[model samples]
Target: MWQKLYEELQDQNFMIIAVAMDSRGIEAVRGPITKAKTTYTSLIDCDHVVSDLYNMVNVPQAVWINEEGRIVRPTEVSGAALSLNLKKMRKTREIYCNAIRDWVTNGEDSPHVYSDSEARAHLPSYTPDIALAHANFHLGQYLWNAGNRTEGESFMRKATDLNPNSWNFFRQMKNLGNRLGSGGPEYMARVRKRSKLGNEYYPLPDMAGMENLKK
Candidate 1:
């Protein structure tokens, strides 16, 4: 998606500053990103600095900022062009690229231009719940790294409850459970449950598939 968007907007002077929300080092994503030759400016959020600032709850997430550095859009789904014919494409990031193209081609007419009130209205009342989940997920990461398995699992489970749609959160929950030797049977069950829910989210990548992402 970054590649497609970058290529489409390269000539239009629009910029996409991607901040990956991974705990891993940049080297982990460098190979995959390089393979795609993504030219957009990308940064690793190993410490999740940018993620916290933007209140990101998931991976493959993005914020659209204007030239003035004001956030034109918050952590919303990146717009990708819809392809009626490509229903079978797995893990399509091109949706974002398509959105970038439409914005460049149509300017204010693009769906990106929502007023503050308009944008706020689009948010579910459970947004704060999801935001809190994002925070707990980060806290879980910290606890896990600090060798507090019990506490980490507790936090991740909270995140999953707050936002069942976040497979990334559940994946972390699963990992934390596995490391603690208590998340196996239940973890497998939860993974399957979330996978079914995630299929509706489109471009559904399995827990293992997206676990390799590095910020």
Candidate 2:
């Protein structure tokens, strides 16, 4: 989806820059990138700096920046262009794609484009605990990179404890083989629990009143 979008809009003065928030480094994303045949600029964030900067709590989020170096949209779950594997989210994908097209053509005039205050309002508020969680997560990444897996897992576990709602931190830790203990819940289990409760992994964007907007 990104490839198609980039191809369509590259000549239109629009670009998509993807940042991978993987603690395992570039090797973890090399195979997927190669398989996808992507040509757009992609960067690896081994320390999740991009995630921290954007307050991203999960994977597959997006932020829209206009030509003047201003944010028109804050980071939000952008499963539409990225969740092709999930057949159930086809409608969402369509909505997201249409919005992108509208924005590309209309620029700031697009209804989806929010003002600075609106964009800031859409962002998740950062609490002191969340800040500490991010710090622990970064330290955990540093320790893991230094070949100290045990200590790394300890810091990561503390991070999860600090910010239980941050799926990004939890998922990254689990992917790095950091199980809390014998009785600790696994990633799949937590995901399933959320699913059963109708908690959307990617919350649907509120497209209310957007139907009348030009597309």
Candidate 3:
């Protein structure tokens, strides 16, 4: 989805940097990325550095950074994805892509672009718990990558406890998922627990036109 949009606007000096926030890195994302054949810059964050930087808790979140290195739009729920072919999701993709095109064409003058103050207002700052959660997540990633699975799992559990609201933390902690495969027993159990609390893993913000996102 992003690739098609990028091609439409790339000639106008637009670029999209899609980052996958997963501890498993390339092994987790190889399938969708390979099948998409995306042309835009795509990278994997083995330690979720990008997620920490943006304080993004959900998958498919995005921020708009302009040529001058300004964040014209701070992080928020994004509709862009590889195939995102669900009917509701396709509508979301279209809405977000159209907004991106408008922003690229009009630059700072676009209504789709947030003003500096508005952008700053949307900027997510870390609280004590979130900060501590990220710290634990990083430790877990380091330990896991260093062949210390036992200790890594311990710290990953801590991170999950510290910030139960972060899907990035939960999903990434669960072996970064198989992408196309079923999430096994433990993962299913956790998802059921989270659902009981009325929070979808990919909870959409209360955007006017996206009421169907919960579906």
Top-lDDT structure, candidate number = 2
Query: Residues 3-101, candidate 1, lDDT per residue (tens digit)?
Result: 665675688868777776555457747877778777788777655666556654455666656667655556654432123435323224444455556
Task: Please rank every candidate by TM-score, starting with the best.
Answer: 2, 3, 1
Relative to the true structure, candidate 1 reaches a TM of 0.65
Candidate 3 has what TM-score?
0.83
- What are the models' TM-scores? 0.65, 0.86, 0.83
Candidate 2 Cα lDDT to native: 0.79
Q: For residues 14-98, what per-residue lDDT tens digits would candidate 3 score against the true structure?
A: 8899998867768778999999999999998888888888898877898889999989888887864323357776777777777
Q: Which 10-residue window in model 2 sums to the lowest lDDT?
A: 206-215
- Between candidates 1 and 3, the lDDT winner: 3
Winner by TM-score between candidate 3 and candidate 2: 2
Candidate 3: regions farther than 4 A off: 80-85, 176-182, 195-200, 205-208, 211-215
Predicted model with the maximum TM-score: 2
The residue-by-residue lDDT of candidate 2 on 1-215, one tens digit each, is 58988888788888889888888889989988888898898888999888888888887889889999888888887745234356546666667878988899999899899988888888888889999999999998789879998999899989988987778888888877743422256766876786787755667565543233212
